[model samples]
Target: MAPKTIIQQESLLQYQCELGEGSLWDAVRQRLYFVDILGCKIFTYEPSTGKHGYQSFDRNVTALALLEDNTGLLAALQDGLAFISFDQLPFPPTNSPSTYKRLNVDITHLEGFNRFNEACVDPSGKRWIVGTMMHEQGFPGSAGGGLYSISKSGDGLTAELLLDQLTVSNGMGWTKYNKTMYFTDSLRKEIGKYDYDIDTGAVSNKVIFSNVDDEELGVPDGMCQDDQYGIWSARWGSGKVIRFTPQGEIDLIVHLPQALNVTSCIFGGPNLDELYVTSAREGTTAEQIKRHPSNGDLFVVKGLGFRGKERTRFQGSFLA
Candidate 1:
């Protein structure tokens, strides 16, 4: 058996977001874009220049995907998906809710749930796979939240429901070859894999990819797949991110004692070899908060010597 490697984490940013999630790396801009779900903010950080800024919103901005042309962003807001632009990023960030134009996509049929929790792009880049969560007080997946998808066609954008029973639809990822899809339902404490169709963006044959049901490991949250087909999952309340192989074995474990409410993670940095993690201080206790003052800060894990797959941009032009 190959010796297990313990990955060490370092603090990347000190800005503690209440419920930080959705870590997306904009390769063209050499920046990382993430959201503070409860803080109702969108943040962008440039690792090389150490430049950081954020824009606040009236509703929670749970997740975001880069537009194909790089002209704007598609954000999963509390009410619905909206289009946003970063053309004004060089200036100080703003707290203007009017900055986003809501997309026509509707989820009123789901009733009661107000926001999406995580999102990912299909291999063709023409479709978006997004999952939802109940913003109000309740257990994670108890709000009847589900998985849905939206695709851009020559006519316009269309929305469709895939899975309808979920509480916290969190981390999402796909294999580099686009042959498999992995989704995380934090409340369920399991990662589900589906046989994916690249041409049609259809997913079927769902199976349990990994189960993190153990209390000591915490709940499974946001996740990203490495180049080697290893899935890296952030364990909420455990302060650790674990790598699981296709054979269902724990390949690696990266820990950040400074934060136990790790919310999400993504592979970024100039080389795409760095793993950036975002955490939360939302439900942390006073004593725990005092001990790990960096509880909600961002972290980075490096030196494992592996790169991640290139991120696919959303091909929709809704902003235009």
Candidate 2:
């Protein structure tokens, strides 16, 4: 189960990304950050200075976290979570958070396209993001969707409300003693297991970590986790990428090419086993986008063990 490695390069921004969740790994500039939510853009890849950076935003940023004083936490295109810079946020991919913080998502379900999808940064740095709907209209937990925990101290604290009506509030994991918090809602293919408290951030008991097959792997958006507690899901339309464990067991299967839909994967370079993948032709069917012409590019292979820990968010306690 190892034959999905394509970074061959060639793009229309990898074919107008319909959804290319977060593929993070910016361990302080080692470089690799992503999001193409409808091509609103915010991508940076520095595979050792092959240097590729682009930032264009007005909303559709999806996710971007790094603020242990690194400053750059913008997840907006709708439901608010801003602290951007590049000079003040029209598309400031770098410096511009001298002071800017807007956290606006707690909608309780009207679901007229409330957005914000796929996020990470937990392990006491809090910023476990999720608020999803509007993939053509959705509303999962009734709150239009759930999952929000922002408290590194930016002032807007509403942490822990982890499941709802559901369209796609995807892939997240933390259990190397981070106390356990695994999540995914790829149209409810189901993948959940929570029992975290991290001194009161709260995420109590929610077991059901694997109930997939989304028309044959095209329903579990994004995910990453495997140091020993495996769970790697990305089967958008069955381009395939699966691995599950912790007694819900369904061990391995990684095969992407002609990418059915694939979107999200992380296990960075420099010993993270390097498994970075993100793909999508957003609602494909130009003959499945010409039978998968790298359906939204970017892929890598060499992941077997597990290699994470480069996530940052909780940035609030004023550097507490």
Candidate 3:
């Protein structure tokens, strides 16, 4: 067997967000989008121009899905989902909030003290899967954080509950064949696999894909899969990312020394060989922040000899 190759990680940006998550890359426009959950902001970056900017929101924005038409982003906000067009950036272009319209689907029934956490578009581009977690004091699977599915078609947006009893529903990814779906419940410290149906976007046969000891490897957060089906998991407290095979075998690990909280990650760059990482500065003391200044910054890993799949866009007329 050939020797293992070491991947190099470097800080790409220095914008310290309180809780940065969800990194999505738009290949056609060559732009990268991410969110600062605690800071209540969404960020955009252009590598060619070396420009980094953000847009503020009244509520926490957890995740974002690139629109199929590449015109805007589908945002999972504190109240519900919304469509944010690119034309209103830098400023709203107008003082009116009409540029950011919340969908008709109401998630307040599902969110008691918690809000939407992490979300992604399904491989078919027709279904958007979002997960939530308890924002206050509670153990894992407590406070009624659950998984939800929002079907988007020409008709409109409709929401449905899929699973309940979760503390922090984090990373999610699907196998290349779209037959297996992997989901991470951070509080449970386990990644669960489900038999997935591409036609209906239904999942069943839930089983354990991998388990992490919080004290040992840290809680599993955001995740993405490479073209080879290797699942790359961003570890929260451990400040690292681990690569595992579909069978749950550890293959490689990438460590970020400049960060204390590794929130999420995604594959980007021209060829999708680059891994963009996001971290958090929340719950840290000023002293700790002084020590690690890049805590809430964005980083990237390149020269990994691996490439990741392009993010699936949401195919919905709601944003049209």
Candidate 4:
């Protein structure tokens, strides 16, 4: 086997989070957005000005995507989905009460311990694919969660179940042409590729694309695709961001020395050349925390000679 390409990463911010998971880059706003699922916070950072801000929520804000109109954000909260207007938020973001327009998705059945996890808008921008996972410890053995696709239904939104009995539905992404979809089941340590129907938002023909069998390499978490068709996956317990070729072969790995639970990553920057990563400090013992002081901080990997295409924004209307 050929020598693996290695890349080094640096911490982007000093503000640590308990479980930083979702990483998104708003190309139009030129800002990076991420979430601390356990912290119930959504964070925004502007690379040009070095401005960082975050807004706290009463429940877990698992994932989010920009609206097509650029009016605001569509977030996956603990129990359901909500639309949040950017203009209504404080510039520097605070714990102040903000308004939320909840979508019509009844997830009460999965309440209690299960919460929404990773989410991504389809290439058509008309549908959003999201997953749910049990959040409690020792819950991996229970596969009570599922995956759903949310889209516009009349004047409101509707969620349709696509897959069931999922233990931990984590990362999700699409191939350049939208002909294939990639999904991660963390506990299973496998990334599955499926036949994607962009026009109808249908997924089928599931096949294992990459399986991480090494215990030390960790499981796959959140992921994003580059312009060159490479999938960049964050390894949860290994503190690494790995790039997998379209053929599901590992070609590059970015190491984060200050972090252990690497959660998610996205491509951002003025030219979309930088990869922004998120890590978690949750479940870490005091000794582990002492060893990896920046375990929960956001990180960036630059000069990778890779670029990411602009992410599709949610096209569904929020007006009721």
Give the C-alpha miss distance for residue 104 in model 1, angstroms: 1.1
Ranking of models by TM-score = 4, 1, 3, 2
Encode model 4's per-residue lDDT on 1-320: one tens digit a residue: 54265555458796789999889898888888899898888888999888898888878889988888888889998788889888655667776866678877644444324778888888899888988886665365557667888888776777778877676888888887789999998888999999998888888999999997875567899999899989898998888888999888888888887888999999999999998999999978898878788899999888888998778898865644
TM-score of each: 0.92, 0.32, 0.91, 0.94
Task: Output the number of the TM-score-best candidate.
Answer: 4
TM-score for candidate 1 = 0.92
Cα lDDT tens digits for candidate 1, 1-320: 65265645457888888998899899898888888889888888988888888877778988889888888788887767788877634434655444777777644436547567788887788888888775566454346677887887564567778776677888888876789889988877889988988887777899998876777578999988777878889999988888887666886788787788888888998889999999999998999898767878889888867787667898867646
Number of the candidate with higher lDDT, 2 or 3: 3
lDDT for each candidate structure: 0.80, 0.65, 0.81, 0.84
RMSD of each: 2.3, 17.9, 2.8, 2.0
Clash counts per candidate, in order, are 1, 22, 0, 0
True-vs-predicted CA distance for residue 275, candidate 4, Å: 0.5
Task: Quote the lDDT for 22 in model 1.
Answer: 90
Leading candidate by lDDT = 4
Tens digits of per-residue lDDT, candidate 3, 213-281, equal 856467899998899989999888777888898778877888787787888988888899988999999
As for candidate 3, its clashing pairs are none
